[model samples]
Target: MAATEQPISYAQDIKPLFREGDRESMSAAFDLWSYDDVVQNSDAILGKLRDGTMPCDGAWPEEQVDLFQRWVDAGMPA
Candidate 1:
């Protein structure tokens, strides 16, 4: 976990997980555009990420996934 106890910000943390083309490519199926959208669908997001079923290319780095989980566990902080 990160040393700082500050809550994760979607803009700072989660949004970066998606790539430059992600919004265009995954638009039809998924949208990681804003905080509310993510917080509302956090369960599905975590599930897919945990199971290595997201990104459509490969699993995220362990640390990245861990960080995301921390965000979720922290009540999906903004």
Candidate 2:
């Protein structure tokens, strides 16, 4: 977790986990477009978090993980 990182904005919650260049994780990867287009498809990003496929290499903490799931379940707020 970075010093100023937010809890679970897609940018804050998910991007830091994987190789952004790849959008893949220890569990699985999204489509090619997902990796390339995170800004427009935050739900896809949240899908990864909701299913607990993120925080790879243990980069994210439980609270952030909770936030990720909540954000997704809440319809991925803008």
Candidate 3:
């Protein structure tokens, strides 16, 4: 099966997207590595990713952003 054809889960697909630095940088606001935190702020996070304002350093690539959107669309499975 193709990558997009498979189910997306937080542990396997979503959480790994956030690097250590990312977790640290966003720590003051939220825990990027935490499922609850991510799900709670998904919309705002998606907006930032779409607008190229996340990471506080640089924007994620189009594919990464799209993957994130897909996870959200999938009901943010854990």
> What TM-score quantifies how close candidate 1 is to the native fold?
0.82
Q: Is candidate 1 or candidate 2 better by lDDT?
A: 1
Q: What is the alpha-carbon lDDT of model 3 when measured against the actual structure?
A: 0.93
Candidate order by decreasing TM-score:
3, 1, 2
lDDT of each: 0.80, 0.51, 0.93
Candidate 1 vs candidate 2, TM-score winner: 1
Residue 6's lDDT within candidate 1 is: 70
Per-residue accuracy of model 2 over 1-78 as CA lDDT, tens digit each:
544544445555455544544544332534433434554555665666556565444345567656656655655434
Residue 3 lDDT (model 3): 62
Cα displacement (angstroms), candidate 1, residue 71, comes to: 0.4
Q: Per-residue lDDT for 76 in model 2?
A: 48
User: Could you give candidate 1's per-residue lDDT for residues 1-78 as a string of tens digits?
Assistant: 358987787888889887877667667766788677777778888888889888778888888888899988887767
Structural similarity to truth (TM-score) of each candidate = 0.82, 0.37, 0.93
Q: What lDDT, from 0 to 1, does candidate 2 have? A: 0.51
What would the per-residue lDDT of candidate 3 be over residues 1-78, giving only the tens digit for each residue?
276579999999999999999999999999999999999999999999999998779999999999999999999999
lDDT value, residue 43 of candidate 3:
97
**lDDT at residue 2 of model 1 (Cα atoms):** 59
